[model samples]
Target: MLATALSASIAGVDGVPVRVEVDVAFGLPGLTIVGLAGSAVLEARERVRAAVRNSEFAVPDRRITVNLAPADLPKEGTGHDLAIGIAILVASGQLDGERLPGTALIGELALDGGLRPVPGILALVAAARAAGARSIIVPAGNAPEAAATNGVAVHAADSLRAVVRHLAGVEPLVEVGPPGPLRGEHQARLDAPDLASVVGQRVARRVLEIAVAGRHNLAMSGPPGVGKTLLARAVAGLLPRLEDDEADEVRRIHSVAGLGARPIGSMQRPFRAPHHTISTQALVGGGPRVRPGEASLAHRGALLLDETLQFRTDALDALRGPLDSGCVTIARVDGVRAIPARFMLVAAYNPCPCGWAGVDGHVCGCEDGARRRYQARLSGPMRDRLDLHVPLAPVVSGLRGRRESSAEVARRIGVAWELQRRRQGGANSALGADALDARLGFEPRLLALLERRGRQLGLSLRRLHRAARVARTIADLEGSSEVSRDHLDEALLHRPKDAAA
Candidate 1:
């Protein structure tokens, strides 16, 4: 007898449908799984067999062959355990195959028949819906996430017995409720470290605001304890919350990474701050199995590199590609997997080896050659990618003054973001050269000023265009329709090269 069950596999942040076909015949009493099954997947046969026996079902003595369709597609994870077990039951005539059609199943099976939650439930639900499946059976623990899908019915099953009973028409598993109507924008309530908490560096704060409004990358150079890290965290808080689509994408990436039960919808933008000692693979994402790195996890959010100069130069340089392309492609022996990484980069570093190169309070203990080499860790190409650079000066007693709260700053940022969205259908940072030309046709004087500055500063065509984009964002913040010379000039001051040199 032959039976088939439906399952799903995750690739990047999306899901791929996989058909599990089982054949039981009068031959050697053995089980075989085909279709490029990974080690974990190949190990599912024992899990399924033990689960069936533990569920008080007879393990048929006939030889069984399980084949995952689309044999070329590499299948990983134990998500197929339940589906394979169910297929075996049907092929053994213990359960009817009629109910299997138009249904997809996803769950890991324990030796005792319990249905364990698996990663990528959201992606699986998405795949099932796209595959036109009438219903999907998932572990009870994963029901909420799977039910988030609107058009499909989701059946929550607790164990193999429950699933078998439901499919056999004895007792149906409980149907999961449809997800609530698109909830209102998730408000970020976590009181982000307030900008007012920082003792000084007013110039740095203003530059950060511009960077947040424009989705521009920023670098902060200062001695330790001058609020560089605090300022970066505050800047993340100042940015507007993610929209519906952006939130969904962020949640999906988190889900795939197995970060526990995320809110069904959230507006809080992701802020990924990896330690300096992180591996190149961990930073860029590539192992025996390719998974999303820090860059991919920070998609549509902020990636803060604290102690930026201390990190591996190769790992730091790897970011240049994703920073420009908004996606990181991991080339594996099997194929290339592209993960979205459209995020604003924020890095903090000391001015020199001793971190006292320019600070007034501290002595310059490091020699010039050492200072040059230390600063050289951050390459020119990498520095050029940053749109804003602010040198954080040492905080003094007199420098401590009243500063704006995150709420007030966020409101201004939200207004600016809305204006950009209305004008260009996207954020200012994502605008292309043609879009800049069409939407932000600058004033004649401003254009001439930008041209002259480009020559004087020896800016590449890319850098010049990016500066104009930032200037446009500055104009948007002021509710101005046209980019002015003042905006252009301020934008130039924030360029990384202007400070790094």
Candidate 2:
């Protein structure tokens, strides 16, 4: 007898439908799974056999062959365990095969027949819905995420016995309702470290506001404890909350990573600060099996590199491609997969090896050559990519005066973001050169100022364009229709003079 069931496999963050075909024939008792199953998946035979026997079902003494269809595609994970078991039950004449069509099963099975939650339930349901599956069965723990998909019927089953009973019509499972939108009435609250907390770096805060409004990359150089890391964290809090569509995209990425609860729709943006010891592959996403790296994980969020000079030059350079394209593509022996990496890059570093280049109290201790080498760790090309560069000064007691809260700064940022969205249909940072020129009609005087500064600063063509874009964002924050001379001057101040040298 032959029976087929529906299942799903994950590739990157998307889902692929897999048909689990089982054939049971009279022969010596044995079982085998084919079709590019990974080691974990190939080991599911013992799990399925033990689960079936423990679920009060008979394990037929015959040759059992399980084949995951679309043999060309590699199947990873044990999500196919339940589907394989059900197919076997039907092939062995213990259950009706007629009820299996148009239904997808996704779950791992324990030896005692309990269903285990699997990752990427949201993507799995999406694939099933696209494939025209009438219904999907998932573990009870995963029902909420599965039901989050619209226009798809989801059934939550607790164990193999419950699933078998539902299939046999002894007691049909209840259809799960749509998951309620994330709870918490104050979900819009953004509790970021306020700019006022830093006391004296008024200029740095203003530049940060521009960066947040425009989604531009920023870098900060100062001695330790000068509020660079704090400023980066505050930027995360100041970013506009994820919209409904953006929230869904973030949830899908987290789901594929097997992370916990789906993110609540909060205006609080993500802040990812990976340690300097991270490998190049870990930053760019690569291995025997390609998985999402820090860049992808920071999608629609912020990627903060603290002690930026300490990171490997290769690892830091890996960000160049994704920074320009807003996505990372990993090509492996398996295939090519693209992952979204649209994120704001913020990096912090010290000015010298001793981190005391020109402080009031601290004297410079590092030699000129050592200082040059320390700065050389970040190549010119990489430095050019940073849109805003602000040198932070140490926080003094007098400078730590009362200032605005995160809520207040967030309100201003939100207002500026809405203006950009309405005028440009996206953040100012993502605007193309032509679109920027058309929308941000720069005054000839301001254009000449940029040209003169570009020549004097020795800015590359790319840097010149980026400077213009930054100036455009500054104008947007000021509620101006065109880039002005004042805006261009302010934008220039944010660029590191030493970097230009």
Candidate 3:
């Protein structure tokens, strides 16, 4: 006898449907699982057998052959344990259904028959729903996460016996609906660093708001004690909540990374600030298993690199592809995988090795060689990718008047985001050269000015395009329909020829 159950396998943050086929026959008592099963999947044979026996279910004393079709697809993780166990019971005549349709199973099994939550439950559920599964059974611990996906019925089971009882119609599992309000008690914006805390650096604050508005990459260079850290962190507060599709993309990525519901509260965008010591692989995502790295983890959100000068050259340069293509592409022996990495980059660095080269009161201690070495980690090409640059100075007095709160800046940012979405369907940074030339709402006069400035400044096409995007964002912030000359001039000021553009 043979039985089949639907399951899914995760691949580079996406999910692929897999069929769990179990065949029981009269032969020497043994269990086998084929079809490119990873070590974790292969280990499920012992787990499923133990879980079934411990659940007080009879295990047929026959050869059990389990195949996760299609045979060419590589399956990893222990998510298929429950499906394999249930299929075996059905194949051996211990259960009624031989073929389960419109239903999918996803869970790791414990030796005592209890179902355990598996990573990527959201991705798995979404995949099952897309594959036409009307309902999906996951571990109780994963119920809330799976239910967040919506559009599909989620049935959570605590143990193998519970699933068996439901399948047998002895007891049906209660359906879990979508969890209301992905946001937590306080909104994410309220919890992030408030812009009012930093007493000075108005220009840096303005640039940060523009960066958040257009999702442009920004770099702040100053001595250690300046408001660089505070200004950089304010991006989280200014950032708009993830749009529906954006949230879905973010959830799927984090879930695939096994982050669970952590760092996803209030349905806020991710803010990943990896340490400077992180390696190239850890920064860009690469290893034997090829999991998503920090860049991908910050998908549709922000990736902040504090002390950017101390980071490894390889790590800093590795971001060039993602900064250009909006995705991190890793080519392994198996195949090439492009992980989503559309993120706003917020980086803060010192002026020199001693962290005080240009400050008014502090004198530089490091040699010119050391300063050059410190700055060289961020290569010329890499530096060109940053859309806005701010050179901060130390605070001078008690307060520079009254600084606006993050909420106030966020209101303007919200308006700018709506303007861009309605006008261009995305942020200004996502615009292409063609879009910059024709699509962006730049004043007719500013177009020729931008081209002339590009020539005088020796700006590349990439830099010209970046300047146009920043100008458009500035215009959006001011509620101006057209990118005025002042907006372009300020945008060009942020992208100096000596630095970025």
Which candidate has the highest lDDT of all?
A: 3
C-alpha lDDT of all candidate models, in order: 0.85, 0.84, 0.86
Tens digits of per-residue lDDT for model 3 on 189-282?
6557998898878788888888999999999998988889888887888787777778778888888888886323457888989999999998
TM-scores, all models, native as reference: 0.96, 0.95, 0.95
The residue ranges of model 3 lying beyond 4 angstroms of the native Cα positions read: 181-191, 262-266, 398-400, 437-439, 496-501
List the lowest-lDDT window of 10 residues for candidate 1.
180-189
Candidate 2 lDDT over residue span 1-501, tens digit each: 999999999888899999999999989899999999998899999999999999999998999999998998999888999999999999999998777888999999999999999988888888877887988999998987777788878999999989999988899999999856653322232445666676667777888888888899999889988888888878766777777787777778778778634544532455688999999988878676566788988888889999999999999999998999988888878888988888999999999889999899999999999988889888877887889898888876545447776667777778778887787678878877666454466766767778899999877877777888888888777778878778888888787554425
Best by TM-score: 1
lDDT of 1 by residue, 400-433 (tens): 5577787787888889999988877888888887
TM-score of model 2 (CA atoms) = 0.95
1 against 2, candidate with superior TM-score: 1
Clashing pairs in 1: none
Cα-lDDT of candidate 1: 0.85
